[model samples]
Target: MSKSITITNEDILQEIKLSCKTPEIVEQIVSRKVIISAAKEAGIEVETEELQKAADLFRLINKLTSAEETWAWLEKHSLSLDDFEAIVYSSVIFGKLSQHLFTDKIEPYFFENQLDYAGVVMYEVVLNDEDLAIELFYAVKEGEMSFSDVAHKYIQDTELRRKGGYLGIVRRQDLKPEISAAVFAVTPPQLLKPIVTSKGLHLIFVEEIIQPELDNKLRNQILTNLFDEWIKQQIQPVEFVKLFELGS
Candidate 1:
């Protein structure tokens, strides 16, 4: 004889539907279970002190007043305080895993490449109006007005405008190929004439270039990349069975 199952909590189904897109409670439960299991398998333990530290750091980073406010902020983002702590623990585990698995391999690979990594300071002038873009480009190129001065006057992006279009140190990989090519072509303190990207015209200034150093920081970054690749490989083959399918 087959066993019959009973549903006790109607609210669980409703909560699952509201929290997640599908009406599948089993899928949600399974997914959460998988994450919790994986976290445990990785020996990702969150100490009380670490959790408090994380809560404090989160408050400071987001400029929140208190830990309760931080919890409220997380809830606003559809996350629970427990979920936040789990994420932090998982992150620490992943970091350790990355260091353990790929530090040695990444160090040699980075050194051989000898990438010309440096800091770049730049100002961008993005205008939907082509005529205005061209006009501003010339204004900047000529001694009529400085890039910062024009950026303050005309740039639309509030964040960049406030900083006088100063884009802080960005890696070569972070920039588009065209921008990166132009930036590397010039010497320090050289102004790059306005180049048009999909966004708009960008006038770049190479403020300072710090030559690449084979330091611990670079090694950690390389290890992080390798570990990210490894994690992707690990999670690729996971299969989930929907609750409705189990009934079928």
Candidate 2:
């Protein structure tokens, strides 16, 4: 025997007000309307095949493998089948409109910012002591000790130690400026002098520096970034008036 509880629309509005998320919710609503209006002006339309493809992607992303799981999800969200279709409709149309608006800019942007996309594959061992890190760096450089040996002995984290402190392919933007400058300054298969940051002394071994490629994935990413900035600019001057007072 369990007690039945029902949450009403009033409850949701009150909670949104109390949580101080009303402005955020209103912003999202206004943004969606803005995108929809833009889509209409650009004559951007969602085709049946495109909608189906987007729906499949939505399901795959949400792990809606079975009809039952999907129904449960919709029930939890208080959404109908039509609502689900509308969600993907807006999303796909916005993406298509973004490509329509910014596709030409991708190539120029990539070449101009080519250095930002450069990445490296390297291993790292962070230490608390600068002297110890310097000792280990020389040991690896002089072939008196191996990076793997230093990692195994001095690295504290079990998983990192086990992997021999291997950090997979890391982009230049992902590292701190100090680390990035030092890491990319020298050529590969080389030992970098110990660099100090807030974290600790970082003894690094640069395995390889991967050059940038303007592939379809990177192109889409660039398009999305451009669209996001453009849309934010569109949102700045627009103001919304709340129909009701919060906590009223």
lDDT of 2 by residue, 19-85 (tens): 9998888888888888889989999888999999999999999999989999999999999999999
175-225 per-residue lDDT for model 1 (tens digits): 888888898777787777677788777666677776677688877777767
Q: Per-prediction count of colliding residue pairs?
A: 0, 0
Error of 2 at 16 (Å): 2.4
Residue 182, candidate 2: alpha-carbon lDDT:
89
Error of 2 at 170 (Å): 1.1
TM-score of candidate 1 versus the correct structure, residues matched by position: 0.63
| Cα lDDT over the full model 1 | 0.68
Report how far residue 72 has shifted in candidate 1, in Å: 12
Q: Where does candidate 1 clash, by residue pair?
A: none
